[model samples]
Target: MPEMTRIVLAARPEGAPGPESFRIEQAPMPEPGPGMVLLRTIWLSLDPYMRGRMDAAKSYAAPVEVGATMEGGGVAEVLASQAPGFAPGDVVVGPTGWASHAVVPAEALRRIDPAAAPLSTALGVLGMPGLTAWVGLDHIAGAKAGETIVVSAATGAVGSLASQLARRRGLRVIGVAGGAEKCAYAVETLGCDACLDHRAPGGAAALSEAIGAAAPDGVDIYFENVGGRTLEAVLPRMNLHGRIALCGMIAWFSGKGAAEPMTLPAVWRMILTRRLRVQGFLVFDHFDRLPAFLAEVAPLVRSGEIVWRESVAEGLEAAPGAFLRLLDGGNFGKQLVRVGHDPAGT
Candidate 1:
């Protein structure tokens, strides 16, 4: 019998998760029961959403129980299959968690074509994050050509795609990021019209000034990602009827369950005066659009028009630290852990 390595939730974090929140454990390799498949994790994705799972909070998804594996999505290779359609050595992507292997229902996994794109991408640009960008900006926000659009976390998995997608639509896109490297990538590679460093001194005032200078015509659409100071900076500059797609509130997440103070009165006044159309979206709600999204984005990615960067942490042992870095804005792009070898050589 093979032994498997896994990370389990040792404690629920009240504030930002620390090393004590998780524990490493050894388990016997999982076996596939009827209608199920056994998988070996190849690439484990470390995303900000996983932070919510580390706490016992009300969310769209259930929190990881104490003493259980930390929940996450990963690209895996089928080691054995008791399910009808799946077979040994097939590549699939699903929620297999922070483990070297998993035994899951066949219905829960989606087969990935190695020929379409790199297998790691099933967790990044060509997968959930990319779909999030497309659905939020195109379907929810309904961004149009010649519009001035702003997206925070511009170099992140979802923000990168949203910023570029907005550009593809002939929108003048301004990206809000934390540092010079990311800001430069947004402008030079992602084709954003301008990129603002939110981590710069003077904070909100600096961001507001940059937005005013870049989008002097006023923001027609705002892809809301980091919500604290970035939201405050964007509020006053919104054009009449400007649309906001509320994707993630990373700043608030840093405070854990604690509510961060906001200029609600000012925000409401601007919303009323600007007639802002704001909608919060979850990517799973639009999973049905996967085929459509893949058809449109896959080609661009293959042609190098939709380029992306990755910051990989080697081994399952590194997942927790890598994830912490992701939440702290330390990662430059998509954060993934190479937990095991990719059989496809991608």
Candidate 2:
């Protein structure tokens, strides 16, 4: 095995992840064990959910143990295979972590078509983020035609997809993002009816007024993200029996959920008086429906009906910066880091 440099958890941060909490170290290429595959990572994905995994507090998954690799999603080309289902050169999606390479059971990952779309999209639009918005919108929110849906982080991975999907389903769409440029992209590229800047002064009031006008009947679906002020504003505007799909919270991720938690008392009032539904979701919980989702979303990617965007960082050394950009909502769409070029890149 050759020497490979990998990022490991040096220390857990008290708030947002900092460079000191992660360190790059020399590690030996891991040989595949029985029923496992050795993978050479090509693209690493940085997502806001990673903030939860960095802490020791018990949650949906175990925290990254000290001295261990920080967990993340990545696309890898098979280097060696001890499993029958996969072959060398195959690209797959896995929890390859913030590392140059890894060894894991092939069952944990789904083999992907590098030709279907950019392999990077396997971590973005046609992948987890796509599935997230689909399941949350379709199953949880029950998004319907003619109804109005409001989404935050509207230019982001999940939010962007949710906006597009809801529109295709015939729903009127509005998006909330960090700045005027992002708002413009959401309305122009992502095909939302309107977009509001969360960074604008009196942004919350602006969002409320925008929703009030766009949804004179009241908002039918709230694609919740950026919890604090955004939620506070969206709460009172929810229509009778509207739906709330909890997505990313880039707001809380920026300050480590330390600034203030947004509790929706007004929303509860709407729930009681209007019979609204608020659901929190994780994409993994809906893995059962992924094949159906991919069936629909994959071709959209190839035909370019569903566009994908990515900010690709240079190498394994660039993971820290990618992680920072994602949490700060500095990225436009999906956040990605290239550990090295894929054979496909050539």
Candidate 3:
């Protein structure tokens, strides 16, 4: 039997997650059964969404049980297979969790070429994060050419990709992110028409000013990611017939189980007066759009028009501490854990 490494959540965290919240364990290698594949993980994607999975409480998806392997998305190399079509050494992406190896059915994973993009990207820009941006901004928010768009976490994985995609669509793009460095990256590197620093004093006002200066008309699409005071500010500035695509609420993840009063009155007034269409969505809701999405986004990425960033945690053990830091915005790009090397690079 093949022995492997894995991380399991030891406890539910009260505040920010600590290293102690998880434990690394050795497990027997799983054997592929009939119509199944044995995968050896290469990369683990640590995202803000994983925090929601740790809780027993209900959300868009089911939570990970206490002793189970931490639920996660990962890229893996098919080491063995009993199913048809898959060969040993084919790369695939799936919800393989924090384990070093996983036994899954052949139908559950899709083979991806490493040369199409970095194999790591299957967990990042060209993967769920990019899909999140593409589907949320274009499909859900209906971002159109010549319209104005704004996204919080502007330089991050989904936000950066969304901003650049918005610009390419001819929409005036306004990016909002923490720190001046990230804001500058969003504006200068990512080609956003304007970027506002959310950490600055009177951040909301500055954002309003920046959006006013950039679009002057108003935001037509608001890709809601951070969603606290950020939502409060963006709600009032939406143009008539604008759309708000609610993606994630990172601000709420840190203060887990703490319910804050929502800006419902403003949300309603804006929707009514300005005719805003604010819709909350889970990314999987549009999985059917994946093929179409890949067709549209892949070319842009290949041409170097779109940039993807990764904040990689070194090993399986680092996932817990890294996850905590991710909630604090301590991570710069797509927060991920590298369980193994990119064999493609070697």
Candidate 4:
């Protein structure tokens, strides 16, 4: 009878979460019930959205109650199955939460071909973040060649792919990131026409000037991920009839900027007068587009036409600290926690 290690929400945070917010404990390994598969988590994905799940507030999803396992998606190896079409040694991807082992329904798991790509990729580029960039840019924003587009979090999981895909489509891509290194990666590697560092002095005002210089034609489309000063900077520069795909607002996820004052009338007037098309979307609402997304982007990934980066913490104990660092703009790319060994090998 092997035991499993899990990290649970110990307490909710006031602004930013810390180590005291999480608790680690051991429990009996979960057993699969009928129509379920028992799995050992391989790679655990940490995204900005998880911050919202920590607060006891109403949102698209239920908040993770204190003392419960933190919710997350991961790639895992099947250890046993009571479900059809699954068996020991099968690698799968699903919502495995913050535990070393999970007993999940077969319907909730999707088997991945280890030969196709790295198994860890199932939690990154070929997974939710990849699909998010695709749907937001292609389906939602309807990005066009010859158009000017700006992507925030430019070197992040979703934004990196969005910047690359937009560049490939011949868009004049402008990127907004935290530091000089990430900004350089966005321009040199992701093929962005320009990249702005929001952390530079003079804050949003300086960023706005940079955006104006980069997109003298005015922004044709904005792939919005961070919604604080970045949004303020981009809104005034939006071209008439410009489209905005409202993705995650990571800046406000931890309630850091929620209390800031903004003139709603001014924002409303800009939208009304400019005829700006703003659409907010959730990735979960667009699962039907996954196959199409894979069909188009998978080849680019395989051929090295599209590249990705990952910042990984070595073990489960590192998750809490890594997650805290992620909220503070410390992660370079897709942030992951490696819980169990990858049988697929590096």
Q: Which segments of candidate 3 are over 4 A away from where they belong?
A: 203-206, 256-263
Residues 122-192 of candidate 4 have per-residue lDDT tens digits of 88899999999999999889999999999999999999999999999999999999999999999999899
lDDT of 4 at 60: 95
Per-candidate TM-scores read 0.98, 0.95, 0.93, 0.98
For candidate 2, what's the RMSD? Answer: 1.7
For residues 76-189, what per-residue lDDT tens digits would candidate 3 score against the true structure?
999999999998989999878898889888888989988888888877788888889998887799888988888899888889888888888888888988888898889888
The better candidate by lDDT, 2 or 4, is 4
lDDT assessment of candidate 2: 0.84
Error of 4 at 268 (Å): 1.7
- Lowest lDDT block of 10, candidate 1: 254-263
lDDT agreement of model 3 with the native:
0.83
Please give the lDDT score at residue 231 for candidate 1. 88
lDDT (Cα, tens digit) per residue for candidate 1, span 218-264: 99999999888888888888999999999999988957424435767
Minimum summed lDDT over a 10-residue window in model 3 is located at 254-263
Q: How high is the CA lDDT of each candidate model? A: 0.92, 0.84, 0.83, 0.92
User: RMSD of each candidate?
Assistant: 1.3, 1.7, 2.0, 1.1
State the lDDT at 328 in candidate 3.
76
Q: Give the TM-score of candidate 2.
A: 0.95
Q: How many angstroms is residue 337 displaced in model 4 relative to the true structure, after the best TM-score fit?
A: 0.8
